[model samples]
Target: METEPSAALMSAIVTEHFVLQSGAGTTVSEALGRSSLYLSALSSSLIALGFAAQTPGLLLPFAAAALPTVFVLGVFTMVRLVGTGVQNMLYLSGISRIRGYYRTLDPEAARYFARWGAGDGETDDALGSLAVRGGPMAGLFTAASMIAVINGVLAGVGLALLTYYVVTDHHLPAALAVGLVAMTAGLAMFFRYQHRCYLRVQR
Candidate 1:
């Protein structure tokens, strides 16, 4: 007679799977939130800077403006790339491949999945849910990243244009310098708050 899986073995398998799923879900959620905040701050800063650029007779600090915008654009691009990579890892199913993918997935997801086999759903449905969550999060990250890049480049162009006028004794105005300084302070505060939130979550 063929031997069947013992009750203990089946339970253990289900438990392991449940734990993994829970962990993954939580991780995706956290990453989504972080990316959202980063995007929001970038958007607001860009908008404020753009407005300051439009007013006639405002001083624009080309180098200072370009520096932070470039840095933020690069960071945003990197975040999107990482987000896409994470989503891809989540969808693959080969044994070794799955192991690698799990490394990128939320640690809590793996543990949660380990603990619950189907979690009250068909096998296919359970897997589908995880994919659904991952895909949307990746898309949101990509959209925000792209917008940030565009805004940064545009802001740089504006600053550069303004600089030519200022240098030729168009009588450099104080607005550019003051605006950049203010924006920097705002960004610092935004990041500080974000860091605090992350720590709270960790705790």
Candidate 2:
């Protein structure tokens, strides 16, 4: 014969479910806040760069200083966003587990919750459905990927400016080629980091 859970046990589980939901919400807010902050700073930097460009012979120097700083900030923001994303996933899993428990207590309630109370695999699929069925490319729509792309462009443009002025004596073609390569490399690195983070989470 199966014994029923005590009132205290049931209350604790409900409280835990609420807490996990709150935590997931917090992670999402934090991700948005961080991304907004990075973008605002980038915008301010661009404005400053524009003002600098208006001055005689100030554009390159100003860009050389500002672009790297923005790129670094973007890198940090991207990493933190990835961390929050993982945390959010863990919180959602916890909430799903609680819903699963509820279904166990009253099997008919499972229908109300849809695939959420089905099983872990089904829950994962349901959660991931928002990202669509595409593979890695689908993941690029995330905040972290947005930051990665911006940072890559910053790095490439900054390097191209330096190369054109210092190495190639204002050779536009060579500089563009170098910039493209740098941008591609930076994006690859950012994507690799994202992959590693998710891989660790899965483990």
Candidate 3:
């Protein structure tokens, strides 16, 4: 006859997995949030400086450099956010896999997460009965919220400034073309990454 694992051993394993998964999820969530906030603040500050730089005379000389600096910072910040989001997806991937194990151990765990959510409803009602299942990410996270919209605005401003700077400094229309191409490529890659992440959860 085949022998099954003892209840005590299974309990210990489940408890340990729960603790580890919880801690990992919290750490990733906090890091991702903080990173996003920092990037947003930095982008806003740069945009502010860009405006200040437009002032005639006085600090204009120093401020003239701010555009390039701000543009570069925004680019780097976007890259970092994209990378951190991938990290978030990885964390989610691992945590969800563990959740699968737990659900198998105790089928009751499955009900804790909602599979579908109502699009229009009172906040309380949605959260209580029909809110999206996953936190922050919400499985794919493809839908744009207010924050995502703001981030896109910031990125748009940065790209516009950067392309303008390239044209002005280099006097080359080709450089502007390149920047546009790069932005499009980056966006395509981002969507691909998100799509793959969403697919992982499906399985």
Candidate 3 residue spans exceeding 4 A from truth: 1-4, 31-33, 36-40, 43-47, 50-54, 57-64, 67-186, 193-203
lDDT of 3 at 104: 54
Worst 10 residues of 1 by lDDT: 115-124
Q: On residues 120-157, what C-alpha lDDT tens digit does candidate 1 reach at each position?
A: 22322333444433221333334334444444444544
- Report the poorest 10 consecutive residues by lDDT, candidate 3: 121-130
**Which ranges in model 1 have alpha carbons more than 4 Å from their true place?**
54-59, 62-70, 73-203
Residues 66-115, candidate 3: write the lDDT tens digits: 54464455455445454444454454444444444555545576687332
Pick by lDDT: which candidate is best? 2
Winner on TM-score between 1 and 2 is 2
**How far out, in Å, is residue 148 in model 3?**
8.0
**Local distance difference test, candidate 2:** 0.80
Clashes per candidate, residues 3 or more apart or on different chains: 29, 0, 0
TM-score of each: 0.42, 0.90, 0.49
Q: Give the TM-score of candidate 3.
A: 0.49
In terms of lDDT, which candidate is stronger, 2 or 3?
Answer: 2
